[model samples]
Target: INHQTWYIKAEWRGIDLVPRMLELFEGHHEYPVTEKVRIDVLRRFGYYSTESNGHLSEYVAWYRKRPEEIARWIDTGSWINGETGGYLRVCTEGRNWFETEFPQWLAEAPKSFAASERSGEHGSYIIEGLETGRIYRGHFNVINGSTITNLPPDAVVEVPGYVDRNGLNIPRVGDLPLGCAAVCNQSISVQRLAVHAAVTGDDRLLRQAFLMDPLVGAVCTPPEIWQMVDEMLVAGEAWLPQYADAIAAAKARLAQGKAIPTRTGYAGAARLHTKTIDEMRADRVNSQRNAEATDKAKLRPAAAKKAG
Candidate 1:
């Protein structure tokens, strides 16, 4: 009876039990055996497919059976005979593994791993108290525990907690500098103009200051005054001081009149600098023509060589 039971167990192991156990072991335990080595391994090759149980399991099994064939496919353009064509290629290039057979699954795992690693690297701000101004600035890992080594105990602080989409905790600090409101209000006009100039990259704010309001232009709108000075220098004006005096006179004339002057300040100076807008446009055209002529002169030798 004992002999019969031993024979029965041996037969069961030989039949389906051994193969099934091997498959299960390979799928879960065997491949992930060395935690230290597996981390570095998965960091390179990534992980296996979590989708399509029977088909994926079979695909993994086939690769495991013939390691040499997979290596050949990587080195030379070779294929393995499987459900997928012999065209399936697998190899590690640089830090990535290229697999043609299970391309989709293999590609997805590494990208997911990289994204997770990137998220781990990004730093988050921490806020401590609502009424006080205490805070911490550093990074923390979700997988491992965090250490809070740095802190300023005497500082007033505000701490607001929030979680991101990846379930990462983020802290917000709510604290304003002293006398911020009064300073902002006092400098609002120039601040708005500077912000507009920064956003638009248009020199109109400078132009407005120099042409419409020289007092404001000289102080708040210095950019326009400097621009006019540059133009005057370019136009071969003998004395900038004289031109500045002329601009000041124009500003005074506009200020005397309640209605905004049709022509004033830097507008008059610009008119004097270029004579007229039509003349300025003509000069620009002439300058472009001169540049083109100079380029053509340089290219003549190249054109002659091509012709020859």
Candidate 2:
């Protein structure tokens, strides 16, 4: 099962997990994964979280928000750790890769295709546990009730749980360490407000949600935050049918010409400028792997070391 990146192979083969990871990264100057953000957090927070660099980076305020700081934390050569819009570009290229490979896969011998190794996704194992009453231990995203006492009960949390004939059964995690829970509770507040604002179409709550977001609040003033939300609503009005009235209100506010200004040049803390095909061809192997791999940070996990 895919519990954590390190735990995946360890769970199956019983390898020494955490220390092996520290040794793997012991003296590397550059990140083997999302190097800067992960290492910094591990130093700041005593516990090692299971999330890889990409997902973990977004949750914290240290890695992103300013251009100057972004360069220090980001790896230009990597997919998950590079500048802004990297995820979208990588996703688009991945789709292109699949589209190009699918016909070739179809025309190839059926036995050749069918005999390939299976994927590492947890879906198959979960099904096996539920169908045959085997116990499968892994991390699952589940709604929080009493599982984490410090977090909002309605929020979703990633935690260890087991599957069996009874289905996915989650137990109380009691409480996260003080630092981790502090981080988690911040996210829960943003998520709770964002969901409520979306469902209720409350502009006030929506603005509050932005203000509560760690990165957004750190990077923008209240008026700037509100205006940014207005711009987003007006731009994405096509999919936001419930926000028609709110969009109209925001447009009227912008029409009055009193809205706080936003920075057009702020490309985000970790975003890189787009490269042309010739530029990408300079590093064909990495470019191709960046485009093709579904989870680019698949083998890489978090590493945190304590001070003596």
Candidate 3:
């Protein structure tokens, strides 16, 4: 989504993926392309600001600031430094990007072939090996426990898999460097808590999930977390049949009148307005390009400046 860095998308076989690929296709160096490809691959693995996902750096800033807590969490010093921690920093943030930029993209859709740009993470799987009875190797993404062995088996994981005639094969990725697993485990804990809370109507667990979130915990106090959770549950009451009792309780709490101070009318730290259709019509070429390009941000003003 970061427009200035669209070239980096070519490196989508991320940190976890490259290692698995190196293992899967170990001895099959048949093509004249292998030498140059290997050099380029190693160069990227060595030099690029490799992260599993976007904006993870923002999330890990919390752990980096508190060394003792990070040490306790990961229990290993091997991956605590700047280099390996880069992977941990690959968590996620930036909801404001979606809120602000997405409407602009959607508005452009009516005037351009924007529909072609929405193929996010969807991949082709049907291989020639299925018809021919010969083995053709390729990588695939599957939903499974394909990450570190220590993570819960039932937890849904997105990882690269080996695909061919038989099926998608998810390999055991042993353990992510301890620190990396620690960061993933934190989010997993929140997800599990949220799921259990929704299924069982346990408001307490839901509150805890909010408290457990790295971004939420870093920004909001306990009182603010509690109030926010209550407000959300109440607002979403219609869809949350299991939360009926909790929503009623939340209304009673809100009725008590004393509310924590909050920043009213706060535009987020990085907010951009969605352009109106008429505004887009002023620059039809760029608007059409933004709508059709998979890297939507590539045509944004800041991105254009950076690209130049």
Candidate 4:
């Protein structure tokens, strides 16, 4: 009767919930009014109880108050099942919903907050936003999680919740500690080129730069360099030109039968000069002992003559 009222006009799909529930609950005392029935209904609509351990209660509360708003949330990729609405139901070995869609939504989402610019460990600046700031920070593969406590407290901070057309902050722009400004004046060319290399999976340019001058490698993090290399290899031919210098240098070293030189001084020069010095000292000591014995023999004869 309920199906006739609610789903009579609805087209049958691969997994129809109402019909399945009706068939499954045909003869029980509770009939269509069981916990299983409720679970089944919620499952079909992509709803689930939030786990006690998850930190999505805020989103869950929002979802409960405005169920219809789920469409917008899902479109923005901010929605999560069990916490928020609109999650893809992918049933493989286990039932899990991936957060793959969130980044896409974040890319288009408005800036929610901004942190005061802070300096990174190696003269790098970290500018974060409060709500949407994590997106940009994560995109650059900078900091982890939400909090920016890892940043220096002395850096000047700024986090305007909203922004205007000129890309200026709306609301309030606060100052972070001065330490946050280390990378603020860094060349965009380096940052952009690095980002482009990563997105395109090209490391050839980075490798060439590093090879031509080893100091270039010191400017970026080790992980960043590895990531660029991985991407370049993945991109194949596009990275060859960039890596040409490094490759040539490697081949040259191989041909000369010389390993890459260590930063430390040469190993062979550290031989023992102590052997020659020790022998000379031993001869001097023996000569001193003989001279002392001759002087004592003369003294003993003079003492015997005085006694006689």
lDDT of each: 0.30, 0.69, 0.51, 0.31
TM-score of each: 0.17, 0.79, 0.59, 0.20
| Deviation from native of the Cα of residue 297 in model 1, angstroms | 49
Tens-digit per-residue lDDT, 1-308, candidate 4: 00000121113565655445445444544422222322333334333221211112221222223344422222121112122211221111011111322354468857454446432331121233333333222112222122234333332223222322332232322332332222221222344455565555455545543332322343345545544444444456454565554445545544564433333653221112222323434564433333323221111110111344
Residue range 188-212, candidate 1, lDDT tens digits: 3344554564355334553442433
Report model 3's TM-score to 2 decimal places.
Answer: 0.59
lDDT of 3 by residue, 80-116 (tens): 1222332222111123233445767677746433656
Residue-by-residue lDDT tens digits, candidate 2, 1-308: 01111121232277655445554554675564457666666566644556555656667666677667666666655556654677776666556555555676578787533425666679988999999999999888888789878777887877779999999999877866678778877878887888998899887898898999887877788878888999999999999888889999999998999977566776565555565555665766666676656566554433344479
Q: Which pairs, if any, clash in model 2?
A: 83-270, 83-271, 83-272, 84-271
Which of the two, 2 or 4, has more TM-score?
2
For model 4, what is the alpha-carbon lDDT of residue 215?
26
Of the candidates shown, which would achieve the greatest lDDT relative to the real structure? 2
Better of 1 and 2 by lDDT: 2
RMSD of each: 31.3, 6.1, 12.0, 36.8
Best to worst by lDDT, what's the order? 2, 3, 4, 1
Q: Which consecutive 10 residues in model 1 have the weakest lDDT in total?
A: 1-10
